[model samples]
Target: MKEKHEIGALILRVVLGLIFIGHGTQKFQGGIENIAGWFDSIGLPGFLAYIVASLEVVGGIALILGLATRVVGGLFVLLLLGAIIKVQLAVGFIGGYAYDLALLTISLFLLMNGSKLYSLDKLLFKAKNN
Candidate 1:
């Protein structure tokens, strides 16, 4: 059971990491100016586009490497929350919010559980069972 649980976490982490990385790359390739313009159109600070993009890229890498899982997951949750509020909410549930909600739930799970097996967190922060 424990092994299965760890494997599940590993799968979830990698999938989520890849998804975030892809989204981040899209934001970049789509042009920061365009994204910032979209952000401004949505009544958000344009500068935030850059910040969010950087976070997604860096956080995605952290997730993929299983480094600082709790921290990265927490940040991802916050980011998703912002997306839900600023964009997904306007799109309505079936339109888009459901996806952000799912991502938020997954991020929350990772935040609470941290990395399991096959993670740098496990290797570097192994508990000393004295």
Candidate 2:
């Protein structure tokens, strides 16, 4: 049923959002500068650490609320892809890219489906149509 699918999406969105929030919080707790330094060591611009951290936190909230879900999901897909390719590729799948791959798939699903019900996007869309 359509409602079942909507519920499924909601569950996925909330869980994924929580995961991202935890990761972003961890980055902050561990020191963004340290993350930046690590990024630099990995051949990424150190400044990107701030951007990535911000996105993870802010985007996680957006996802939980289902605000601009597609956009946030799109960004997450790119972010995960970059992590998999740039950082985890050499480490192999079992403990390396596996998590990232899972996250990427969830993001891709959200990107494609957006949000249907019990979401800010749905509320706003309905309001606009009324």
Candidate 3:
């Protein structure tokens, strides 16, 4: 049971990390400009869109390596919260809330649990246990 839990957590971590990275990559590639323009169209400050994009990209990379997992996860949680508020809240549950919910849940989990075995944090912290 313990092993299964660990495996499940690790899987969630990896998948979530990958998704974050992809989001970040899209922003890094200038997709955020388009997104920002959209935000502007919708009465939001275009700059905020870029800020969210940058945070997503940076936080995503950190999550992927399990480096500063708690911090990154927390940041992601904030980002997702903003996303939910700015976009999903009015769009209804089926529109964009689902993905944000998933990401937010996983990020909160990571913030609470941190990384697992085979993570940079594990490697760095392991010596203190022995």
Candidate 4:
């Protein structure tokens, strides 16, 4: 296997997508209403639960497909930041912000790098470096 950053980006994109997909699916499986109530308890609007869940699932799919990579990355960054600030910060690094920070870093990478090669941006948009 060649050690190409494109391949690495692809792997990162897919894995991140899978993680978000699983989380989003879990939210639905556990009941959107319950998630909504939890969101309200956390000082966020209950409707946000549906939006977040939808973003996670839809954005994850978009990531895997290499579509709108930068856009999806930006959304992920915002979501992670919100999670860290609104909830995970209280739990401390061991079980909270650490993982979120990692995800945020990856999101930042995707935002900055724009999925590198092997992406829709490159294929369809004819992005020079993406």
Candidate 5:
């Protein structure tokens, strides 16, 4: 049973990480200045574009590696929530929010549970039965 849960976590982490990496790479390909321009058009600080892009890229890697899962997940949840409030909500659930909502839920789950079996966190910080 525990192994099953661990496997589930691994699946979720990998899928979510891949999605983030794709999106992050897209942002980079589109150019940070262009992203910042879009952010400005949307009434957010232009500098946030770089910050968000960096978070997605680096956090995605951390998630895939199962390093600091809780921290990365929490950050991703916040990022997705911001996207929901600032953009996706206006598009409505069917149009945009469905995907964001799903990602947000998964991120929340990871944030609460952290990584399980095949995680660097586990290997690096294993408890000793002293």
Candidate 6:
């Protein structure tokens, strides 16, 4: 049923949001410069790493609060796509690529569907209607 699907999607959104927020928190603990340094060490553009880290942190918050869920999800999909192409694909599915792939799929789904019932988005919609 539609209700069941909505509940499942909400659970997925919360879990994914928490995981992203946790990783972002690690980055913030040492600040964006630290993350940028790590990216530079890997031969990546340091500024871009900061951008990705910011997106993960702020986007995770957006998702957790169900605010602008589609926009955040879409941004995350782009972020994950970059990760998959830049890092995971060459390494193959051996070292946790499966998990990343699953997350990417879920993010894409969220982008398409947006937050469901009981979310801030849903409440906003209802408030506007009423």
Every candidate's lDDT: 0.88, 0.93, 0.80, 0.89, 0.90, 0.82
Ten-residue region with minimum lDDT total, candidate 6? 121-130
lDDT of 6 at 46: 91
Instruction: Write candidate 5's Cα lDDT for 1-130 as tens digits.
Output: 8888889999999889899988888999989899999999999999999899989988988888898999999999999999999999999999889999999999999999876667788777778312
Candidate 6 per-residue lDDT, tens place, 1-119, comes to 98888887888788888888887878878787988887888778899877787788888887888888888888888888888887788888978467789989989989998766568
Residue 95 error for model 2, in Å? 0.6
Evaluated at residue 53, the lDDT of candidate 1 is 91
Q: Give the winner by lDDT.
A: 2
- Model 4 local distance difference test score: 0.89
Writing each residue's lDDT as its tens digit, candidate 2 over 79-127 gives 9999999989899999899999999999999999977667888787887
lDDT of 5: 0.90
User: Please, what is the TM-score per model?
Assistant: 0.93, 0.96, 0.84, 0.91, 0.95, 0.88
**Clash count of each predicted structure:** 0, 0, 0, 1, 0, 0
- Ordering by lDDT: 2, 5, 4, 1, 6, 3
Residue-by-residue lDDT tens digits, candidate 4, 1-130: 4448778888889889899998999999999999999999999999999999999999999999899988999999999999999999999999989999999988888888767456676677775544
Worst 10 residues of 3 by lDDT: 57-66
Question: Candidate 3 on 1-130: residue-level lDDT in tens?
Answer: 8778767767777788889778878775867779878989988899987787777777776666767888888888988898899779888888669979988999999889876656777777788648
Number of clashing residue pairs, candidate 6: 0
Model 5 TM-score on a 0 to 1 scale? 0.95
What is candidate 1's CA lDDT for residue 82?
Answer: 92
Runs of candidate 3 exceeding 4 Å displacement: 128-130
Evaluated against the true structure, the overall lDDT of model 6 is: 0.82
Off by over 4 Å in 2: 127-130
Q: Candidate 2, which ten residues in sequence have the lowest lDDT sum?
A: 121-130
